[model samples]
Target: MNDYNYVVIGSGPSVFRFLPGMQGSKQRILVVEANDFGGICPNAGCEPKIFFEGASKISLLSQKLTGRGMANPAKIN
Candidate 1:
């Protein structure tokens, strides 16, 4: 059960950059990875979801600049 003409299961990064162009090309390639391998946009969807969406857009711009008072409501932690 080790016969493989080509079994790229996927480890992302375009399967290690197209698997060295299928080496010699004679066949028998098997890269089966279940996890932890540059998949899902570098392990879990794009840089921690863009750092929690930039901290929820700076906590909604500091709650809209403290409700237009021009910034003084700092407690978003």
Candidate 2:
């Protein structure tokens, strides 16, 4: 039905930002998102990917530095 004044796609941060600027006005905004509203970064984007990468890096570094100077390197848990 043609009832809404606005039809926003991908309910990401950008969508949230646009709504506030519409304040008090009867905009009848309608947000439609196929994925998580918050988007991919916090869900499965680079932000979360970094943690896994970091852990793998730490494990690699420890193995390389083992038996060189320190007594056994830190193991990845």
Candidate 3:
């Protein structure tokens, strides 16, 4: 079996930040992630939540203004 000088758990933001410095090094490195790559913040966390909330807000605003000012309610699909 091969040896690793660094064993990083999860390919999260910190891992990304740490990798740039190891660019030309010959040290063996291993990164392990059980779920989708790029971590939770981009996959199932803050980013997705922000998009969902923004869409929902826009949809609701469109619904509310459908007759008041907007010609039609916006549909989210």
Considering every candidate listed, which one attains the maximal lDDT?
3
List pairs with backbone clashes in candidate 2: none
Could you tell me the lDDT of residue 30 within candidate 1?
Answer: 80
In the predicted model 3, the residue pairs found to clash are none
User: By the lDDT metric, which is better: model 2 or model 3?
Assistant: 3
lDDT over C-alpha atoms for residue 32 of model 1:
82
- What would the TM-score be for candidate 3 when compared with the true structure? 0.57
Which pairs clash in the backbone of model 1? none
TM-scores for every predicted model: 0.34, 0.50, 0.57
TM-score order of candidates, top first = 3, 2, 1
lDDT by residue for model 3 (1-77), tens: 98999999999888999999999999888999999999998787777668988999999999999889899888889
* lDDT tens readout by residue for model 2, 1-77: 66999888777667767888899997798888788777776566666568878988888898898888756766656
Which ten contiguous residues of candidate 1 have the minimum total lDDT? 67-76
lDDT of 1 at 1: 69
